[model samples]
Target: MNATKYIILLLLLPLLFGCSNDGINNNNRYLPNYGFSVDINMELPLYTNLQFTGNPVYIDQAGVGITGIFVMNTGGGYVAYEATCPNQEISECSGMFLQGITAICPCDEAEYNLFNGQSTEKEFPLKQYRVEVVNPSVIRVFN
Candidate 1:
């Protein structure tokens, strides 16, 4: 059409289509379709009749911006929780610790039960990553 009309269209093109590399859908929202995975090797003492305690290992998934993994023995089994705080959405918040079957957040005193991933004092629970026990010495955490 006219040169003036073409110029106007060009100026609005960037706004019409989002400026980010993430693809924009029909609803004018950017969607992130891809994520990352991490495999961590955790060394725990082999269960024996003489040994009653096992060492806890922390795994940091750097690709996903994870600071650390909080691993603790629950007497019956092992429980793992992410170090990030769900309330503040910060990776540097105080980590979680095992209290009975629950994981307590040191930042806001939010306690989450490791048994079912439910909060005891607060309504929101800690964000939990998927953990797969590969063997006696390996565990993989994934989104």
Candidate 2:
């Protein structure tokens, strides 16, 4: 109510609401631009005869840190995403697992459907990278 009290409240207001356990602004914080590209043939072998059934493969690109390539059994389609948790950005506990049609984050059990990249329960979605199948054996991942 007083002038001194108002000043103290003003200074503490930002600290009160701007802080989070994840240490990032949940509402207004922008996701970092982690644009990168990877050539698949030079990185791993593409099994053409052996059918891939919704299995995720971890790949470490030269420039990009770590990425997960989810190969969907449906028509040989694939979805590639960064191995970083969107909720906390903890690189160590960020890899995802293929659960039916979703990729479950190991950190907080945040499940994201690899089909659309949307979180199954949470509002946030996993950061997805663009994938282009150059040929039957080659693929390119870009952010």
Q: Among these predicted structures, which one has the highest TM-score?
A: 2
Tell me how many clashing residue pairs each candidate has: 0, 0
Off by over 4 Å in 2: 1-30, 42-53, 65-76, 97-101
| Each candidate: RMSD | 11.0, 11.6
TM-score of every candidate? 0.48, 0.58
**Range of the 10 consecutive residues with the lowest summed lDDT in candidate 1:** 24-33
Give the per-residue lDDT digits (tens) of candidate 1, residues 1-143.
69999999999998998655322121211111224455554433432211123334445546542555555444565555565554554545555565555556777878766544566555455555555567766555554
Best-fitting candidate, measured by lDDT? 2
Once all C-alphas are superposed, what RMSD does model 2 give against the true structure? 11.6
Q: Report the error of model 1 at residue 26, Å.
A: 25
lDDT of 2 by residue, 1-143 (tens): 69999999999999999854332122313246555777666234553421365545556545663444444333556666665566665566666666566677788888776656667577666666666788766777775
Model 1: lDDT to the true structure: 0.51
